[model samples]
Target: MTGWIESDRWAERARELRDEGWMLMDLCGLDRSGLGRSVVNAGGAGTAGAGFRNAEGTGGLYGPRFEVVVQLLHALKKERMTLHVNAAGDPPTVPSVVEVWPTANFLEREAFDMFGIQFEGHPHLTRILMPDDWEGHPLRKDYGVGKVPVEFISQPLMQIDSPGQSPETVAAERSVDELGQSGPPLRTVEEG
Candidate 1:
């Protein structure tokens, strides 16, 4: 089962589902800014819009720029449910389910780190994958693509003087026979 819940009622609905024995399976964010080229229908069929509609039946041509998807599972009943909550505003904001599900802490942080979707009431909403100094969310459609030079740790170069130690110096002072052929020797069919 799948349903779209309003952003304001996100936490409340999540709590209700939790109380009903639904286990929070996964939580992630989506950036709908690029949906103009490809359409995504969240509310299944019968909707008149290109995107999905919330529980209150509110949705536009493309809905909100950001949305949070929550997956829940009822283990004993063998049932699964997907919930979509639209995040609105300059920095898309959605109610955090971390309080209801402790596992949501890292998932919500990742959404914030990659898509810049702010999870309101998140106890510690910090960057999980990117460095603290990262300027913008890399997964957002509007974020600029820029190259970042990777600085590797400096290490002392080892001096390899023995033959075969390096590819450039392989068998430098030895004949092919001295090197010795690797693997089993080739035999004719008659020998076998």
Candidate 2:
């Protein structure tokens, strides 16, 4: 089951769910900046037929730039439900659910670290995955992507430690000249 809740009523709704024997299974943030345009322009292709509207009933498809998704589980009942809350400010801010569910502490912090979603009233909302000095949210759609070179390490074809297998056995089966021709050529950084 899934439901959309207004950002202003997020914390209140979360408390109600908790009192109703629901456990916070997971919480995450999402960037839905341009999704409304894409989905609306795509006509019925991307529409889920569930007709989503903002708090003001403006008929906006996606509502906001950021969203906070909360998954709740009724363990004894073996049921699950998801709540989506749109964060509507510049630096998307949402009320913290840690007061209702202590387990949401780190999860909210992670959302803050990755998507720049601020959890208001959090005890200590700091970056959990990235360095404290990290500039922008890494998972944000508009965040600049940095290009880093990746190095691959070459490994031997056969395991020398395996039973009935040794360096000598491998050498006898395939000579160095044959191995060089069969294996891919190793290239230096300059070559790349």
Candidate 3:
């Protein structure tokens, strides 16, 4: 099951669950900046995952810009729980659960690397995936989608100048541009 909790009560609730035999499995960040985007169609055909609703069920985009999602597991009982905590302000932040689970060190670092969600009280919070000089959080929805183009090198076919020797003497020779195209001439001793 999943439950959304306030940001201020995040560490408090996490501690409660830990005492109840819950172990932190993973923690990640979310960018809900443009949740209003149409999930069904880009042109806004239907409303499924878009639009923000307040605690009172009123509709608006006034929700927090970022959120932290955590997965918890009960070791012996074999049960799971999902917890969500909001992170607000110009630079969103949440209390680190590293104290509760040492494994959260890497998870919270990854969240910070990808989404720029600060984990307060973390021993050494730094970029875990991206380089230290990286410009912005790549996983955020507001980040621009950049792409690099690839180019292919064309190779010409080799030729066997020896007469009486079949064209297949070179064992599957072909040109990169087109089959049987002229390429670098390979002179044979038999021709001399």
Candidate 4:
């Protein structure tokens, strides 16, 4: 089963789960900013997973906005539990669980990198996929899909404009000499 907890009580709930012999399985964040449609549908239970589904069949598995989700496994009991924490903030801040499960370090970093959610009390919260200088969080629904324009420089051997022309014409146009070095211009195809 999945239980929803407030952001302030996140760490405490995690500790409780740990005391119950639940090992942290996974940790991540969710962005529900612009999900134009409701999570529930005629398909029965909507997008809510087994754990997030409310008894009232509401919209989501967690809060209406951002959420930090954790999966726990009970090896001896052969069972799993999902925990949800509502990250309510402009930038969405949640408590760090690294102290509870050291494995959360990398997983939380990845969540922050992709979603721009902040983990309070984290030893180091930084980008894991994008460069440090990257501008925006890529996974956020409101994040723009920025495009980088690329320019290609052509070399004599790699020139693409000589599709129908002979290599000799290409070499001449590029002023490449017999030694494949730039030298005096050679006769053009028409000149020859």
Clashing pairs in 2: none
lDDT of 2 by residue, 120-157 (tens): 99999999999999888988887757533335634346
TM-score of each: 0.65, 0.65, 0.64, 0.65
Where in model 4 is the C-alpha error above 4 Å?
36-64, 144-192
Question: Cα lDDT of all candidates, in order?
Answer: 0.74, 0.76, 0.73, 0.74
Q: Could you tally the backbone clashes for each prediction? A: 0, 0, 0, 0
Error of 2 at 192 (Å): 31
> What is the per-residue lDDT of model 4 for residues 91-165, given as tens digits with 9 covering 90 to 100?
889999999889999999999999888999899998998999988788877776654443453334535463687
Backbone-clash count (model 2): 0
For candidate 3, write residues 43-154 as lDDT tens digits.
1212243443443542332357788888888878877776667787767889898998899999999999999998899999999999998888999987867532334644
**Candidate number that wins on lDDT, 1 or 2:** 2
Worst 10 residues of 3 by lDDT: 38-47
Full-model lDDT, candidate 3: 0.73
User: What TM-score would candidate 1 get against the native?
Assistant: 0.65
RMSD of 1: 11.3
Winner of 1 and 3 under lDDT: 1
Better of 2 and 3 by lDDT: 2
